[model samples]
Target chain A: MDSRRLFSGSFSLKNIHPSVLITAVFLVAYPSFATDFFIFQIGAYSLILGTIALSLMMLAGYGGMVSLAQLTVAGLAAYLMAILGDNSMGVMGLGWPWWLTVIVSVLGAALFSTFIGAVSVRTEGIYTIMITLAVAVAFFYFVRQNYVLFNGFTGFAGVEPPTLFGVYWRDPVPFYYLSLVVAVGFFAAVSYCARSTFGLGLQAIRDNPRRMRALGYNVTLHRIVAYFFSGIVAGVGGVLLVWFNGRVSPGTVGVDVAIDILVIAVVGGMRHPIGPFLGAIAFVLLENFAIDLIDRERFNMVIGAAFLLVVLFSPDGLLGLWNRVRDRLRFRGNAQLSAERVNKDDPASSGSLEKS
Target chain B: MRNFIERHTFWAIVLLLVVVLFLWMIFAVWPDWLVEAFGRKKTFVNTLLNGVTLGGLYFLVASGFTLIFGLMRNVNLAHGSMYLLGAYIGYEVADRTGNWFLGLAVAFLAVAISGVLLQVLIFRRMANDDLRQTLVTIGISIIAADAMLAIWTGTTYQFSPPDWLFGAADLPIISVIKSSGAAVYIKYPVFRLVVLAIAVAVGIGLWIFLNRTRIGMMIRAGVNDREMLAATGVNVQLVFVLVFAIGAGLAGFAGVIGGTALSVAPGEDIRYLLASLVVVIVGGLGSITGAAVGALIIGLAEQFGLAYFPTYGVVLTFLIMVVVLAVRPQGLMGGRG
Candidate 1:
């Protein structure tokens, strides 16, 4: 019945400790797997998606802004990299170095997100969703039609993944490990930020914007920073996605996929950092299997059904369910312990306690 | 007032138009030279026509978008999927009945039923929660789109109504200036004209419904204040369900018209969904007039951009959206909600 231990457990859940278990499991098991495609395609893809969803979770869960344009930012980065790099066939090709190209792409994504966030953050609730959705659509069509930069419907191709450390990084194993490292790093960064004063400030703002404004917290600045941070995660994921696929197209960053990220975040539970990974795993696995079993066209049906069911049954997502089960078990154990204590302290009181 | 004309905003637009006209004149007067300088003018015009037709279809889609957003205060992302559903239903009906009118009627009704079902089953449950409602509708949209794709096998289906309505028409309006040596030909599809008519009719009907009917009064009240309306014993839940159904029904009707005008294929739903969203955003959510105005502006932008700036045509709608949002966050009409 010690209040100190209860607080400690809750604090640990909010900190980087739980991630240690997840990271240990991944690192230990990943090397033993021999399938290159499994490591690179499935594992890498999930990590990349997880990173993108993590960014969304920060925005929606923390800032109360459910953006439908996060994927657009990621796509924009991928497209910018392809268009500005040496391999581009576009008219505005810069032929820049890979490092410079990646930096510019990420910056471009951040800037784009800032512009969207600036306008969108002004509104709250569904209006914000619509605004971001509009921006995403506009970007999608713009890329699909503009051949000079986006290369029209075909999009930019032959954008090679960078070779580093005398290794072909495009290989599934390397890419998987790369994604794993990046995901872990980004997860840690977000986890750290969430415990920081700024994260607490953002959460406070989300809870009551008027009150936060009264407290002299620059609400808009906090939101913009969150957006910039979210954009960075999405931008990184986009870079990895292009490298993994070896191509960038309008289809890669369309509205459907943008919504899919939101779905992943919500399904995994927006309450924790691990939620994105859980959601991403479930989404990617469901998508892969659904596509395999059903007609390719009907695969989205399964996803849609899952989305509806998850939202209706569990507003808190998978993490919420896990916490609920854990809480129930703990409550039962505490009850049994209390009964034993009662029996030892006051035997007569036990009969009354049992009746009660 | 005189100085206003010389401002950068005014001059910049004038300069743009001048440049565009200069380019047009160069292409028209120096055919062979212009062909060498730029791409072919005929091809450019054809692409422009394509853009216009595409924009027209988008207008239809966006019109429905504006209507739904204006009344319900619900951003139904599934509007696009409803559009796709309408197209598939129309295609199936047409294949079976061999009658375009019948197919359209059946498709419209089928889509309306789906819309009502959605309102009752899903959106009704999400009355107060906007985010959850959006998520759920998006889920429904995806499901509808996937189901359509599954049934249709994701293959592009061609739906030509009639021979006369297939391509552009040579009207008497063009014949009057035949001897003037001017390109006065305005080639347009009959189906597009039908779309225009339907849009106008629906617009009128919506206006009347809101202004004249008892149910419309209840809907307007609900839009203004759901609790107030419910307190007044207006059956707010029923009103919400009806509003959603009507919104979805309009989307479906737009889909049938759009499909006939354009090709119905996989991924078309998302494209139209985006377009419709833009329409509502620029037009201001929850205002029919705003949606119409937004649709027209977007339609014309797409048309002209495709005609002149073929490469940047798709970006035109988005650019307008950005500009509109930047300049007027409440949209042009300033919705009550």
Candidate 2:
């Protein structure tokens, strides 16, 4: 392996994809060109969702653990923020400083995630889904039932984002930028970690835990630690989410929202960090405009159908679909040329091709 | 039982003590102190009975799930939708014809046919991939949930049992002796008792079908090793469809029964699905007896928790699952595989 830093297997600045740079620039310049609705609802909202989905992607994609409690963990953070910070509900607010509240909330979520991981890591593969789902549902019900702590069904509303540096962060452009920073930070961290020793070992454990155990790795510990990291990512997203919504409720952590996170992560493709954002954008767009095509209540059906199609045809999601199309195009154009060269250039396609 | 006692005398003694205490609590009139400490004897007994009866409903739903999982390694997440669908169909039939039994029969047959369709069209295409099966089922659940909402709307529907099953039946258990020297017995809903009886009958029938019958042997063999069963010239695909049909039918049957006992609505699917998932997890997968035991434990825990601690009732069920996962990841009766 090369000593140089790699971003999604790229070794140098010149090796970076043009599309990635364009997307980055476009996201940065988005607030200036777009209206507040596009800036906040479409832009920031997608980024927040994408960040949460990215945490799930990191777990399911790299760590081989499909946890449905990512949203629950995010919800916990949001709830904590509402409790610790100013709230209009006259419930559990301690009026703590924003920085302190955010830090504590993130750590609390991470610890909670770690506990969930500890409980669920005992089971393998499919059972992981069942366990995490059970936990998510349990938390949702707990929050809904407990009035003394979680304010019961109504939850906390009027949770305002702090005014920092003489600017209100919750405003459209500012919130969009805040979400973008968090999103980009998490995206970079996940991508960088994918090549790091821990990430490689995590992937190794995912592929064959028994073999990794024989090789003297603490497979359970590694997976649990991965959950902690993913929790932090989700926790930040949760804080941003509460700020974005201006409230936190039991509905925020409901099973439907949890499933939506899974759908986003899956529909984006779980293979890479960027897949989550791609998926989140598509999901957000669909969710926003679904009313135009059909009744708002039937949006779930449309998304479910789309998800089924993607799962059936391309198990890897839209990112995988793109890769396949690109590979096919390259393969067709180079039929008379060296097929081996193309294969060497893209290992993902080569492995898929061989499997087929 | 003798072998178990011989192997674990301590556990046997503990079990005996618990049983004796339970029997004493039921048979003997609670002293004043006991009554004050534990609230009303009627409430206590009712909660226990409700828990056990509710367990019957859970068993009906979960047995099918474990059966499919045991045979196909597929977790049909859309199963809840099937339950809701059956309830709606059963509700329609019963309402239109004014025959509850006919409604139950129609719901079973209709859901079974749909199950057959699913087996042929979707599952047959991806026979080996469990993940894909799970994803497909999730997608199906989403679509089915929406479609059902579109058709039935979101109103809660309750089934009206016949007059005989409508009222309560007097139980032999003594609740209290009045000052006038009359013994008052506990009265419970007759329909709930009937549900319990039906569950017991189904459990025994399933056990007999699985253990005594020849096809049961084939199913057991297939659950252990599908390729080997196929190599032995068994019509594996036919067996798959048959099991799917039966399993799906059981869920539908339970839907009608449960709808009568409880109510049918949009989100009932998720509630029952969660129940089945937790029950199966605690009971051990691919085992009928495990489902029964798990359902009993979960049902009792849920009812007791609701009675004693209403706020954290869901947590009680969840804690059982977590504890089971921690202590025995394979579940209590799950094979060592």
Candidate 3:
């Protein structure tokens, strides 16, 4: 019976949430009914931003390191991609093959992120925000000022995605599917890792780094490695982002954009893997449509207010709100069953149940 | 000083040499070869003066940040918004009332009131949750930034200081000798010198406040251990509110002064915020002296870099930060960490 329960517990069809299934179906069929603008601008853009925010989520949620330089990492990849691959900037475009450029750019970003991690991990707790922020701002100013490598003020433009397998990757449908595939892949990867030994150790470290170190875990190395992995995620997102915009500019890696990535991750939820995507969808939609609903200038105020409310009321974000509401309904429906379920699920409470 | 030299013999020697060289650069008349090697004496002195004055402005902004962070453990990301709001408010008040001093007074009071409201409303509700507090501040900053933009378009604003504060004053430093062999002194902006004087005044004021006053002692104790301070019946919340008010007020005050020296524009908030962040990181969080040192180093690096290397100026400031972070992760004067 125990084996059977283990087999049917998580992966069973019935275990899948109805909402998740519906969203998956809708995403797959989105291009069929939606206009090109909606599919590309809203859907693909959200997925790209979500993937980037997910990297931040991985660090802040599980690793307890809230890096503002994640966007800077992504921007480095984007700039590298622009430099190595085709670009109309006539700057440093080496015109390497697209595949090679993507690989190198992602690795470069990971290495850079790892370096940032190594530097920041020397300090602890709240110092992470200040250190990473300094790095991000420094990179922004450096790129804007350095003309030889970064092309200075006017960044690279017209960096297009490669045509592969008889399909233009930048086309609305293809890009949407591309972004969706990458986003879902990362989402699943994060979910799986969250249960892995490494992730469990990370969470343990987050809860108590000194204790983890006392228990013989290399806390600093684990954190730096997490940064490397998150860098990969952010790098891929950056590649997709640059492709989405067909350009890479200093504005892409500016301080405001760096903070915006943090906002998206925090607003969505830092606890779950899906939170970034959910947050990204809301953000992208608000960005696109808020101008119509409110004054174009007031959009940041609206989003800021929304973000403030979320932080104040639901620290866990929309997902937390959903869980709270669901729990309330479940509690109202059958209080006894809910209490029994908690007793059954939680090992700490099982002792009382046994005594009873 | 002997203890420091014993502890960090190499650094102490380096510091001593740097001071000697700096004094020589400032007071010693540059020979023809020296001028040829390092460019004009006028440019070098001007760069040094600009760096110091800029450091003064940075100290004003960062001291408050370090104070608030040291006491409450809250990273007020909205601190920059307060600075910009102060600058804008000061500009308006000074322009309308034609009294720059009144503008400064009102800006400080107004921003201090807002800081109090933020403490009572937001920070108090979410005590002990640093990340959440930071997020809320970011949210507030976003809203505040947008609201300000809506009110004060994108135009850059500069403060017209009192007429007495206008024009450059001749410094004692000799810039060059004329063909007739007359020594020519270097001239610098009067407002910038006043700014530097005010910064030094605030620094001494803060030092005396922290060391000589009972309320300052309470703040210091609170920074070390809030729980213990509260347990001692010190009214911890009141201390936090007071520190936040002073910290926020200083930022606003700096905004008006800095705007007068430089220019107030849309992106000035982010610039000052970055400067404060870097200053605190290099100086050591929560230490006024650290903020001063860090600001001076950063300001000097930026100006010297700009004067010497046209393109890689930002990198010089960044390199100082990286080197400091690598050498002392706790910052130069940071202790409580």
Question: Residue-wise lDDT of candidate 1 within B230-263, one digit each (tens)?
Answer: 8987777677667766777777777778888778
lDDT of each: 0.75, 0.89, 0.89
Model 2 segments beyond 4 Å from truth?
A1-12, A335-356
Task: Give the Cα error of residue A288 in candidate 1, in Å.
Answer: 4.1
TM-score of 3: 0.95
Ranking by TM-score: 2, 3, 1
Could you tell me which 10 consecutive residues in candidate 3 chain A have the lowest summed lDDT?
Answer: A347-356
Which should have the higher DockQ, number 1 or number 3? 3
Lowest summed lDDT window (length 10), candidate 3 chain B: B328-337
Q: Score the docking of each candidate (DockQ).
A: 0.36, 0.59, 0.56
RMSD of each: 7.7, 2.3, 3.8
Q: How close is chain A of candidate 2 to the true chain A, as a TM-score?
A: 0.94
Expressed as tens digits, the lDDT of each residue in A58-118 for candidate 1 is 8877778888899999998888878788555555557888999889888888888888898
**Candidate 2 residue lDDT tens string, B1-337:** 7998999999999999998998888878888999999998999999999999999999999898888888987888888888988999999999999999999999999998888899999999987767678878888988999999999998999897689988999999999999999999999999999999999999999999998999999999999999999999999999999899988999999999999999999988888888888988899888888899999999999999999999989989998998988899988778843
For each candidate in turn, the TM-score is 0.84, 0.97, 0.95
**Clashes in predicted model 2:** 0
- Stronger candidate by lDDT (1 vs 2): 2
